[model samples]
Target: MSEVITDVPTEAPSEWARHHAVPTREAYRRTLLDMARLDPRIFCVDSDMGGLEDGFGQELPDQYVNVGIAEANLMGVSAGLAHSGLLPYANTISSFAASRAAEQVKIDVAGNNLPVRIVVTHAGVSAGHYGPTHHALEDIALIRPLPHMTLVVPCDAAETEAAVRATADLPGPLFLRLGRARTPMVNTEPYEFRLGEARLLREGEDVTLVATGPYPVVMALEAADLLARQGRSARVLNMHTIKPLDVAALGRAARETGGLVTVEDHVRIGGLGAAVCEAVAEDHPCPVRRIGVPDAYLDFVAGERSLLEHVGVSPERIAEAACDIVGRRG
Candidate 1:
């Protein structure tokens, strides 16, 4: 088990938090590289992901393995490495890692309870131009049910770095979902990132906005701002850890806020929205509205921003959904 750090920072937001300069993948690579350099036991197993070749591959050739296009083999090799007492960070696209090599991930990693970090990039609709084939629409749903698996979806590059460092020595399988595009930093102010614990971004009394991933959290914050202007105090919770969810936080929201709205970049059926509804229904039932992609294939070609907008995962749409949920209470 990883040690939980609960020391929250009390300083003002930094200037780096105001910029959207670093891609989450880049942060993951840099942090992985730094850790690998200090610890020779850390190995990086890749599946034709070219971004790590220059830094990780060249700097530590013996510690890197490119399995070439075979995602199942990638997981298998990583599991083998873990069995030999070495920590491995398996690299692949989110769609392939969750779909093609899912069986290996479930059995080889999760079943054996190995400490394999499955760091997948291009999560959800981040690979928008690649069509539905590359989109990780159902990854959270597929991985959430597996035993001994820890799911984490960081909101930005800074949080991605914090998550990588925090979960480095975690015991058991981990799924770290990351996006391909550069995203603005959400943790501008000092904050504590505890595994399986939800971070409270903003406090409100009317409704709570729960979200994960980079863009969804940004949209949630924007929605909270919009709601504040309209006399609706909206609370924002960055539910970064999907599996082993912060149920206690949900209970508090249900009791205090009375209503909730969940936002995610994936489909509504089995992603963050579904998880939130499932948790709140049995424990503390409240009026909840989910804002996410519909249950269907997106056949159109567009950029990440365009696809997210079409799926109604925007600030305007999230704010509207929050209003609807709050209005139902009145």
Candidate 2:
């Protein structure tokens, strides 16, 4: 069994621990740096977002280039690098990288099916204090519809590191959605990273909680535990990959569980929730309750946890939703 955090610390010993229990972004940078050292074709283009002293920018100056806050140009430049037989990884905020540079991304990268890795940070509402514009709640909706686009959202730091390394050989345009803040480690045990396979974190029968991204997956696990306490069996699936979803796992969950509850940091319209519903409805036809951000946007900025709770995707709410779904099965 994976090492479950038995004692939840009320007070964090350090500020770094408080904000970043597991530093996913830092892990991404470090992994990229290590990979770049071995691969001569590895190059990085940043939209004035990557920290100067981190990753490619500082360590490998020749392989890194900053496009001065221009998202569209960033994609364009990365496309050029890809055309020159270089494996380029583009770094930028999720909203700007997806929405601000949509046209360029479609034409320059995805259109030609270039082997470029577009690693987007601050995905979903993880950009809490930055509010709606920075909160990429619709990034999955935007990228998943494009042809040749592969979307991967890692659940935690370990998965993020594994996913980054896994993208090295993956073909076509890959969109990696990464959260802004620290999250608790979920995949503590060693496991192989597959592009389209979903990991079953916990097994049960009464209900299934399918979730992606760090916070939502953790919430789903907590919800499963809560359901267990009430004598209900709830399974948890860490659906790390958003595109090319693990349909086989979804079918199994539907066959075994009473229903499925999809939890995500993005809106219910076109993220993990919609993807789960789409697959299950056509293949298995199971009852699915989509728990996430509603149709409206958060106008004001707040802390990540507070913003998530305000939008009603909190762990407590997820547990309640699971209870409702399982209760209706009777």
Candidate 3:
């Protein structure tokens, strides 16, 4: 079991404990509900998503709005609420939010520079059991290019809460990605979560494993351990914030490590891998290998773990990629 962090309050519930695992969406819900109680401007807007059913809707009825399955209108209504000086947390599935409501998100929220927090759940292939239609393989590709958009993919429940609380007062639009199931805790010790800052999880010299999202980050850590057994030092970086890419950290990794293997649940086209490649290519030249879903859509449906393994995002694959990079550099 992982040790609990000192930074988290003693009086905090067990869910906040570093070792205790919880769903990222649950953390978002609890944190948002607490914030809503203190701030009158905060509102929970759901598009047939049941995130606010626990308390935000039942206890604080006035602060919650259910738009009933309309993803586009969800963005429009949230944007309108933001325009009226209200902080709206729009909850929806990642696939629908990015695909169906792409226009509203691009125009209504990002274009106007509204402070609407688009909290999308079931990010990446976490909802793979529901098939390709539910998989959010291209969400980052669709939303990352929008102007004034802050895209964040938190690693676990703890970081998800931190991101939600940290970005409460942030300017412009925000896209917060979350997974559907509970995940292992990435940070077992006290650490500061600064937006757009890459948190170095493990130190190494041979290669760097930069990853985002819950499973990817976990797999990166595991891969680092696997590499250690083989006398290979693999640096692990939890790149929670994708949009404002941490070039300083990447630069250091490129210069010091000489190679980087980016891991993510999304596609390699415009997701975290692409972002890292673009940053390193322009500033610090290095061998950056991307381990993510291919450009083609998955035709068959399967469990999240099965899908992840099929796409070569497991700890074994990540470790092998790191070893290959280290060998090539030698």
Candidate 4:
């Protein structure tokens, strides 16, 4: 389990530096191909997504399996492959993988504690125009409770690649939640990444903004900058790992910062915000504000950005929530 964990300053460049957004899904596709080249035991099973199948299938056809819309069967086969001493990566849409194939995931994957990596794309509302059926609002809620299921939400393409590489030898069920949007590289500089350890992007005392997933993290950094303009010092934490719940970082933020603001692209109920509140409630209780999609289904919106705005999880909304929390505490 080789891991790269380093800290870099998240500050604006003096000159005009181009920071390109990397799609985590695309990163996963590339990383998978690279890993498979060295490790023959690594097998990729897709539920008709065709990206992995097209990319790796051309080179290593024997190591690729396309289950053709049968998401449940995809999990079952991946579990079987894992049992046969093969590392299986099951790829599909988040909603289908977490909801449609949930039973197989629970009994076959997590229950057995197999080394199966369930890589899901279009998580949360990143599916854009696909609407609710495709939107994976409760993926964390559904997967978090399962025994031995390690949940991860990478902040960007680079982190996603590092996560996929790091989890190669982790001998248990893992879920990698990814967005479809091309999120800007928040950690443009090289940094070390550790499983279950929260990365503090910026240090401040006014308020703490904890974010998960790709777009939410980018938005969190933006929200932090927005707060800075108004004379509020905001700390940003990219909580990529959700299941382990970095309670130490959570406790420190609560103790040092004025208040806490958790941002996630998922539903507000059992998402990142809920996880942060759960951790803080026991050790360090504070004015914890949660920003995410509401409990109701997003019926009025169509595109991803519109749906996110409707739920008040946009950058501006998150900044307002942080300011409001700081103001109330003051």
Best by TM-score: 3
lDDT of 4 by residue, 73-175 (tens): 9999999999999999999999998899999999999999999999998899888676667889999988998999999999877788778878889989999
lDDT of 1 by residue, 1-330 (tens): 111222312131123333434778877777787789889999999888886766688889999999999999999999999999999999999999999999999999999999999999989999898787889989999999999999999998778878998899898999999998787788765566799999999999999999999989999999999999999999999999999899999999999996899999899989999999999999899999999999888998788868998878899998998888888888
Per-candidate local distance difference test: 0.88, 0.83, 0.89, 0.85
Itemize residue pairs with steric clashes in candidate 3.
none
- Of 1 and 4, the candidate ahead on TM-score is 1
Question: Whole-model lDDT, candidate 1?
Answer: 0.88
TM-score of each: 0.93, 0.92, 0.95, 0.92
lDDT of 1 at 77: 96
| C-alpha positional error of residue 158 in candidate 2 after TM-score superposition, expressed in Å | 0.8
Question: Whole-model lDDT, candidate 2?
Answer: 0.83
Residue runs of model 3 more than 4 Å from their true location after superposition: 1-17
lDDT, candidate 2, residue 109? 95
Q: Residue 234 in candidate 4 has what lDDT?
A: 94
